[model samples]
Target: MKDLLIRSATEADFNAMWDIFHTHVAEGETYAFEPGISREEGYDYWFAPRASTFVAVQTLAPHDRRGRERVLGMCKLQPNQVGRGAHVANASYMVSPYAQGVGIGHMLGEHSIGEARRLGYLAMQFNYVVSTNEVAIHLWKRLGFAIVGTLPKAYRHRRLGYVDAYVMYRLLDDPARWPLPEPAPEEDD
Candidate 1:
Protein backbone atom coordinates (compact mmCIF):
# COMPACT_ATOMS: atom_id res chain seq x y z
CA MET A 1 0.00 0.00 0.00
CA LYS A 2 2.97 2.33 0.46
CA ASP A 3 3.32 2.39 -3.31
CA LEU A 4 -0.22 3.55 -3.81
CA LEU A 5 -0.77 6.67 -5.93
CA ILE A 6 -4.10 8.43 -6.25
CA ARG A 7 -4.61 10.90 -9.08
CA SER A 8 -7.02 12.14 -11.69
CA ALA A 9 -7.74 9.34 -14.12
CA THR A 10 -7.03 9.55 -17.84
CA GLU A 11 -8.57 7.63 -20.70
CA ALA A 12 -5.49 5.42 -20.77
CA ASP A 13 -6.38 4.12 -17.32
CA PHE A 14 -9.86 3.01 -18.31
CA ASN A 15 -8.86 -0.54 -19.21
CA ALA A 16 -7.67 -1.31 -15.70
CA MET A 17 -10.52 0.67 -14.19
CA TRP A 18 -13.06 -1.33 -16.14
CA ASP A 19 -11.98 -4.50 -14.42
CA ILE A 20 -12.72 -3.19 -10.95
CA PHE A 21 -15.89 -1.48 -12.10
CA HIS A 22 -17.24 -4.58 -13.83
CA THR A 23 -16.45 -6.88 -10.94
CA HIS A 24 -18.18 -4.73 -8.33
CA VAL A 25 -21.26 -4.10 -10.43
CA ALA A 26 -21.45 -7.77 -11.39
CA GLU A 27 -21.57 -8.73 -7.73
CA GLY A 28 -24.82 -6.71 -7.44
CA GLU A 29 -24.30 -6.11 -3.74
CA THR A 30 -23.13 -2.53 -3.23
CA TYR A 31 -23.73 -0.31 -6.27
CA ALA A 32 -27.01 0.23 -8.06
CA PHE A 33 -25.71 -0.01 -11.61
CA GLU A 34 -27.12 -2.79 -13.74
CA PRO A 35 -25.04 -5.95 -13.49
CA GLY A 36 -24.64 -6.16 -17.25
CA ILE A 37 -23.92 -2.49 -17.96
CA SER A 38 -22.04 -2.33 -21.24
CA ARG A 39 -18.65 -0.75 -21.51
CA GLU A 40 -19.94 2.27 -23.41
CA GLU A 41 -22.68 2.96 -20.88
CA GLY A 42 -20.15 2.61 -18.11
CA TYR A 43 -17.91 5.12 -19.84
CA ASP A 44 -20.62 7.75 -20.10
CA TYR A 45 -21.86 7.17 -16.57
CA TRP A 46 -18.40 7.28 -15.04
CA PHE A 47 -16.88 10.12 -17.02
CA ALA A 48 -19.85 12.36 -17.57
CA PRO A 49 -19.04 15.98 -18.40
CA ARG A 50 -19.73 17.18 -14.87
CA ALA A 51 -17.84 14.38 -13.12
CA SER A 52 -14.26 14.33 -11.96
CA THR A 53 -12.74 10.87 -11.91
CA PHE A 54 -9.87 9.70 -9.75
CA VAL A 55 -8.02 6.41 -9.46
CA ALA A 56 -5.65 4.74 -7.02
CA VAL A 57 -2.84 2.87 -8.68
CA GLN A 58 -0.21 0.38 -7.56
CA THR A 59 2.75 2.38 -8.81
CA LEU A 60 5.38 -0.27 -8.25
CA ALA A 61 3.83 -2.90 -10.44
CA PRO A 62 6.25 -4.01 -13.14
CA HIS A 63 3.69 -5.28 -15.63
CA ASP A 64 2.25 -1.96 -16.62
CA ARG A 65 0.05 -2.21 -19.67
CA ARG A 66 0.59 0.46 -22.35
CA GLY A 67 2.07 2.79 -19.76
CA ARG A 68 -1.06 2.49 -17.64
CA GLU A 69 -0.82 1.72 -13.94
CA ARG A 70 -2.85 -0.95 -12.20
CA VAL A 71 -5.89 0.76 -10.74
CA LEU A 72 -6.88 -0.58 -7.32
CA GLY A 73 -9.80 1.74 -6.77
CA MET A 74 -11.76 4.57 -8.38
CA CYS A 75 -14.01 7.47 -7.35
CA LYS A 76 -15.94 10.05 -9.31
CA LEU A 77 -17.17 13.37 -7.96
CA GLN A 78 -20.00 15.38 -9.46
CA PRO A 79 -22.83 17.71 -8.59
CA ASN A 80 -25.78 16.06 -6.82
CA GLN A 81 -28.08 18.01 -9.09
CA VAL A 82 -28.17 20.70 -11.72
CA GLY A 83 -28.57 24.51 -11.52
CA ARG A 84 -30.40 25.23 -8.27
CA GLY A 85 -29.01 22.06 -6.67
CA ALA A 86 -25.47 22.27 -8.03
CA HIS A 87 -23.93 23.35 -4.76
CA VAL A 88 -24.30 19.87 -3.37
CA ALA A 89 -21.85 17.16 -4.38
CA ASN A 90 -22.31 13.50 -5.19
CA ALA A 91 -19.68 10.78 -5.42
CA SER A 92 -19.32 7.03 -5.83
CA TYR A 93 -16.39 4.70 -5.19
CA MET A 94 -15.16 1.20 -5.98
CA VAL A 95 -12.19 -0.81 -4.75
CA SER A 96 -10.69 -3.95 -6.16
CA PRO A 97 -11.92 -6.98 -4.24
CA TYR A 98 -8.31 -8.11 -3.93
CA ALA A 99 -7.40 -4.85 -2.22
CA GLN A 100 -10.24 -4.61 0.26
CA GLY A 101 -9.51 -3.90 3.97
CA VAL A 102 -6.13 -2.34 3.21
CA GLY A 103 -7.46 1.23 3.59
CA ILE A 104 -7.90 1.81 -0.12
CA GLY A 105 -11.54 2.63 0.34
CA HIS A 106 -10.75 5.02 3.18
CA MET A 107 -8.11 6.80 1.15
CA LEU A 108 -10.41 7.19 -1.84
CA GLY A 109 -13.20 8.47 0.40
CA GLU A 110 -11.05 11.11 2.09
CA HIS A 111 -9.56 12.19 -1.20
CA SER A 112 -12.97 12.59 -2.74
CA ILE A 113 -14.11 14.73 0.16
CA GLY A 114 -11.14 17.04 -0.17
CA GLU A 115 -11.66 17.25 -3.88
CA ALA A 116 -15.31 18.01 -3.41
CA ARG A 117 -14.54 20.80 -0.97
CA ARG A 118 -11.84 22.15 -3.22
CA LEU A 119 -14.43 22.38 -5.95
CA GLY A 120 -16.65 24.55 -3.72
CA TYR A 121 -19.37 22.10 -2.83
CA LEU A 122 -21.50 22.98 0.20
CA ALA A 123 -22.06 19.32 1.10
CA MET A 124 -21.92 15.78 -0.21
CA GLN A 125 -24.77 13.33 -0.46
CA PHE A 126 -25.11 9.68 -1.30
CA ASN A 127 -28.49 9.10 -2.91
CA TYR A 128 -28.87 5.39 -2.51
CA VAL A 129 -26.66 3.40 -0.21
CA VAL A 130 -27.66 -0.22 0.19
CA SER A 131 -28.59 -0.77 3.83
CA THR A 132 -27.28 -4.30 3.81
CA ASN A 133 -23.83 -3.01 2.96
CA GLU A 134 -22.83 -2.52 6.55
CA VAL A 135 -19.17 -1.96 5.81
CA ALA A 136 -19.93 0.94 3.49
CA ILE A 137 -22.43 2.45 5.91
CA HIS A 138 -19.95 2.25 8.76
CA LEU A 139 -17.20 3.72 6.65
CA TRP A 140 -19.40 6.59 5.50
CA LYS A 141 -20.44 7.29 9.06
CA ARG A 142 -16.85 7.23 10.24
CA LEU A 143 -16.02 9.68 7.47
CA GLY A 144 -18.54 12.15 8.90
CA PHE A 145 -21.62 11.33 6.86
CA ALA A 146 -24.96 10.86 8.65
CA ILE A 147 -27.90 8.77 7.57
CA VAL A 148 -30.29 11.57 6.71
CA GLY A 149 -32.96 9.35 5.14
CA THR A 150 -33.83 5.71 4.71
CA LEU A 151 -35.90 4.53 1.76
CA PRO A 152 -37.53 1.33 2.89
CA LYS A 153 -37.41 -1.52 0.42
CA ALA A 154 -35.72 0.76 -2.09
CA TYR A 155 -33.05 -1.67 -3.20
CA ARG A 156 -33.75 -5.18 -4.38
CA HIS A 157 -30.87 -7.08 -2.85
CA ARG A 158 -29.82 -10.15 -4.71
CA ARG A 159 -29.94 -12.42 -1.71
CA LEU A 160 -31.86 -10.44 0.88
CA GLY A 161 -34.89 -9.88 -1.33
CA TYR A 162 -35.98 -6.22 -1.03
CA VAL A 163 -33.80 -4.27 1.37
CA ASP A 164 -33.70 -0.66 2.47
CA ALA A 165 -31.35 1.98 1.14
CA TYR A 166 -29.93 4.97 2.96
CA VAL A 167 -29.36 8.55 2.00
CA MET A 168 -26.21 9.82 3.69
CA TYR A 169 -25.14 13.44 3.89
CA ARG A 170 -22.08 15.35 5.11
CA LEU A 171 -21.51 19.06 5.27
CA LEU A 172 -18.00 19.72 4.01
CA ASP A 173 -17.50 23.26 5.32
CA ASP A 174 -17.36 22.53 9.05
CA PRO A 175 -17.66 18.86 9.77
CA ALA A 176 -16.83 19.44 13.42
CA ARG A 177 -20.11 21.28 13.85
CA TRP A 178 -22.23 18.36 12.71
CA PRO A 179 -24.57 17.04 15.38
CA LEU A 180 -23.62 13.98 17.40
CA PRO A 181 -25.79 11.08 18.43
CA GLU A 182 -27.18 11.03 21.98
CA PRO A 183 -25.24 8.61 24.15
CA ALA A 184 -27.11 5.67 25.56
CA PRO A 185 -28.19 5.89 29.19
CA GLU A 186 -25.94 4.23 31.78
CA GLU A 187 -27.27 2.08 34.59
CA ASP A 188 -25.78 2.14 38.09
CA ASP A 189 -24.57 -1.36 38.87
Candidate 2:
Protein backbone atom coordinates (compact mmCIF):
# COMPACT_ATOMS: atom_id res chain seq x y z
CA MET A 1 0.00 0.00 0.00
CA LYS A 2 2.98 2.28 -0.31
CA ASP A 3 2.57 5.58 -2.11
CA LEU A 4 -1.15 5.56 -1.34
CA LEU A 5 -2.21 9.12 -0.65
CA ILE A 6 -5.44 10.55 0.76
CA ARG A 7 -6.50 14.01 -0.42
CA SER A 8 -9.36 16.27 -1.33
CA ALA A 9 -11.35 14.86 -4.22
CA THR A 10 -12.18 16.87 -7.33
CA GLU A 11 -14.68 16.47 -10.16
CA ALA A 12 -11.98 14.65 -12.16
CA ASP A 13 -12.14 11.81 -9.64
CA PHE A 14 -15.90 11.35 -9.87
CA ASN A 15 -15.86 8.55 -12.43
CA ALA A 16 -13.63 6.34 -10.29
CA MET A 17 -15.63 7.36 -7.25
CA TRP A 18 -18.82 6.38 -9.04
CA ASP A 19 -17.38 2.99 -9.99
CA ILE A 20 -16.60 2.15 -6.39
CA PHE A 21 -19.83 3.65 -5.07
CA HIS A 22 -21.91 1.80 -7.64
CA THR A 23 -20.27 -1.52 -6.88
CA HIS A 24 -21.11 -1.23 -3.18
CA VAL A 25 -24.62 0.03 -3.73
CA ALA A 26 -25.38 -2.66 -6.27
CA GLU A 27 -24.18 -5.26 -3.79
CA GLY A 28 -26.89 -4.00 -1.35
CA GLU A 29 -25.09 -5.29 1.73
CA THR A 30 -23.71 -2.21 3.47
CA TYR A 31 -24.98 1.20 2.44
CA ALA A 32 -28.72 1.78 2.19
CA PHE A 33 -28.57 3.70 -1.06
CA GLU A 34 -30.63 2.16 -3.86
CA PRO A 35 -29.05 -0.10 -6.47
CA GLY A 36 -28.18 1.16 -9.97
CA ILE A 37 -27.90 4.67 -8.57
CA SER A 38 -27.65 7.09 -11.50
CA ARG A 39 -24.43 9.03 -12.00
CA GLU A 40 -26.20 12.34 -11.43
CA GLU A 41 -27.73 11.00 -8.25
CA GLY A 42 -24.36 9.64 -7.20
CA TYR A 43 -22.75 12.99 -7.90
CA ASP A 44 -25.37 14.87 -5.95
CA TYR A 45 -25.04 12.52 -2.99
CA TRP A 46 -21.28 11.99 -2.91
CA PHE A 47 -20.12 15.31 -4.21
CA ALA A 48 -22.81 17.64 -2.94
CA PRO A 49 -21.78 21.26 -3.27
CA ARG A 50 -20.57 21.43 0.34
CA ALA A 51 -19.51 17.85 1.12
CA SER A 52 -15.89 17.15 2.00
CA THR A 53 -15.16 14.34 -0.43
CA PHE A 54 -11.85 12.56 -0.42
CA VAL A 55 -10.11 9.79 -2.32
CA ALA A 56 -7.28 7.34 -1.82
CA VAL A 57 -5.11 7.10 -4.90
CA GLN A 58 -2.39 4.66 -5.86
CA THR A 59 0.34 6.96 -7.11
CA LEU A 60 2.41 4.56 -9.18
CA ALA A 61 0.61 5.88 -12.24
CA PRO A 62 -1.38 3.80 -14.56
CA HIS A 63 -2.88 7.22 -15.10
CA ASP A 64 -6.20 8.03 -16.68
CA ARG A 65 -6.25 10.17 -19.84
CA ARG A 66 -6.32 13.23 -17.58
CA GLY A 67 -3.02 12.05 -16.03
CA ARG A 68 -4.45 11.42 -12.56
CA GLU A 69 -3.48 8.53 -10.33
CA ARG A 70 -5.82 5.59 -10.01
CA VAL A 71 -8.46 6.02 -7.33
CA LEU A 72 -8.52 3.11 -4.89
CA GLY A 73 -11.24 4.38 -2.57
CA MET A 74 -13.42 7.34 -1.66
CA CYS A 75 -15.23 8.91 1.32
CA LYS A 76 -17.13 12.05 2.26
CA LEU A 77 -17.19 13.88 5.58
CA GLN A 78 -20.03 16.24 6.35
CA PRO A 79 -22.21 17.53 9.13
CA ASN A 80 -24.34 14.73 10.53
CA GLN A 81 -27.18 17.20 10.75
CA VAL A 82 -28.04 20.83 10.14
CA GLY A 83 -28.56 23.68 12.59
CA ARG A 84 -28.78 22.29 16.15
CA GLY A 85 -26.97 19.02 15.39
CA ALA A 86 -24.35 20.30 13.01
CA HIS A 87 -21.50 19.87 15.49
CA VAL A 88 -21.52 16.14 14.91
CA ALA A 89 -19.80 14.92 11.77
CA ASN A 90 -20.95 12.08 9.54
CA ALA A 91 -18.93 10.21 6.94
CA SER A 92 -19.29 7.38 4.41
CA TYR A 93 -16.50 5.38 2.79
CA MET A 94 -16.13 3.11 -0.25
CA VAL A 95 -13.03 1.17 -1.20
CA SER A 96 -12.60 -0.50 -4.55
CA PRO A 97 -13.36 -4.22 -4.20
CA TYR A 98 -9.90 -4.92 -5.57
CA ALA A 99 -8.40 -2.93 -2.69
CA GLN A 100 -10.42 -4.29 0.21
CA GLY A 101 -8.74 -6.17 3.10
CA VAL A 102 -5.44 -4.40 2.58
CA GLY A 103 -5.93 -1.66 5.27
CA ILE A 104 -7.33 0.96 2.90
CA GLY A 105 -10.53 1.26 4.89
CA HIS A 106 -8.60 1.69 8.10
CA MET A 107 -6.48 4.36 6.47
CA LEU A 108 -9.60 6.19 5.35
CA GLY A 109 -11.20 5.93 8.79
CA GLU A 110 -8.16 7.40 10.54
CA HIS A 111 -7.92 10.23 8.08
CA SER A 112 -11.63 10.97 8.33
CA ILE A 113 -11.47 11.22 12.11
CA GLY A 114 -8.58 13.63 11.98
CA GLU A 115 -10.25 15.65 9.29
CA ALA A 116 -13.45 15.82 11.29
CA ARG A 117 -11.62 17.18 14.26
CA ARG A 118 -9.75 19.67 12.14
CA LEU A 119 -13.04 20.83 10.67
CA GLY A 120 -14.21 21.61 14.24
CA TYR A 121 -16.72 18.88 14.68
CA LEU A 122 -17.31 17.98 18.32
CA ALA A 123 -18.17 14.35 17.57
CA MET A 124 -18.70 11.85 14.75
CA GLN A 125 -21.74 9.69 14.27
CA PHE A 126 -22.55 6.93 11.79
CA ASN A 127 -26.35 6.99 11.66
CA TYR A 128 -26.92 3.56 10.16
CA VAL A 129 -24.31 0.86 9.77
CA VAL A 130 -25.76 -2.51 8.79
CA SER A 131 -25.18 -5.01 11.58
CA THR A 132 -24.08 -7.65 9.08
CA ASN A 133 -21.02 -5.71 8.01
CA GLU A 134 -18.42 -7.20 10.36
CA VAL A 135 -15.31 -5.78 8.73
CA ALA A 136 -16.59 -2.24 9.08
CA ILE A 137 -17.90 -2.87 12.60
CA HIS A 138 -14.48 -4.13 13.70
CA LEU A 139 -12.62 -1.27 12.04
CA TRP A 140 -14.88 1.44 13.49
CA LYS A 141 -14.54 0.02 16.99
CA ARG A 142 -10.77 -0.15 16.68
CA LEU A 143 -10.83 3.43 15.51
CA GLY A 144 -12.54 4.51 18.80
CA PHE A 145 -16.19 4.66 17.77
CA ALA A 146 -18.68 3.13 20.19
CA ILE A 147 -21.95 1.52 19.25
CA VAL A 148 -24.07 4.09 20.95
CA GLY A 149 -27.37 2.60 19.93
CA THR A 150 -28.97 -0.09 17.80
CA LEU A 151 -32.23 -0.14 15.93
CA PRO A 152 -33.85 -3.57 15.79
CA LYS A 153 -34.46 -4.96 12.29
CA ALA A 154 -33.37 -1.69 10.82
CA TYR A 155 -31.92 -2.63 7.46
CA ARG A 156 -33.54 -4.74 4.76
CA HIS A 157 -30.42 -6.48 3.63
CA ARG A 158 -30.52 -7.69 0.03
CA ARG A 159 -29.69 -11.32 0.83
CA LEU A 160 -30.13 -11.52 4.57
CA GLY A 161 -33.77 -10.47 4.65
CA TYR A 162 -33.89 -8.18 7.71
CA VAL A 163 -30.94 -7.11 9.87
CA ASP A 164 -30.25 -4.74 12.74
CA ALA A 165 -28.48 -1.43 12.28
CA TYR A 166 -26.09 0.32 14.63
CA VAL A 167 -25.50 3.94 15.50
CA MET A 168 -21.78 4.23 16.06
CA TYR A 169 -20.39 7.34 17.68
CA ARG A 170 -17.18 8.93 18.94
CA LEU A 171 -16.36 12.23 20.61
CA LEU A 172 -13.72 14.26 18.81
CA ASP A 173 -13.16 17.25 21.07
CA ASP A 174 -14.50 16.49 24.53
CA PRO A 175 -11.89 14.61 26.51
CA ALA A 176 -14.38 14.39 29.37
CA ARG A 177 -16.64 12.33 27.20
CA TRP A 178 -13.94 9.93 26.04
CA PRO A 179 -13.77 6.73 28.04
CA LEU A 180 -10.52 5.98 29.81
CA PRO A 181 -9.77 2.38 29.10
CA GLU A 182 -7.06 0.61 31.01
CA PRO A 183 -3.84 0.09 29.12
CA ALA A 184 -3.36 -3.32 27.57
CA PRO A 185 -0.11 -5.17 28.17
CA GLU A 186 0.31 -5.61 24.44
CA GLU A 187 -0.78 -3.06 21.89
CA ASP A 188 -1.19 -3.53 18.17
CA ASP A 189 0.84 -0.42 17.45
**Structural similarity to truth (TM-score) of each candidate:** 0.87, 0.88
Q: Tell me the whole-model lDDT of each prediction, alpha carbons only.
A: 0.89, 0.91
Q: Model 1 Cα displacement at 89 (Å)?
A: 0.4
Residues 1-189, candidate 2, lDDT per residue (tens digit)?
976999999899998998999999999999888896789999999888658999999876545455448899988999999987788899999999999999999999999999998988889999999999999999999999999999999899999989999999998877776445558688687
* Candidate number of the best TM-score: 2
- The C-alpha stretches of model 2 lying farther than 4 A from their native spots are 62-67, 175-189
For residues 96-125, what per-residue lDDT tens digits would candidate 1 score against the true structure?
A: 998999999999999999999899887999
TM-score attained by model 1: 0.87
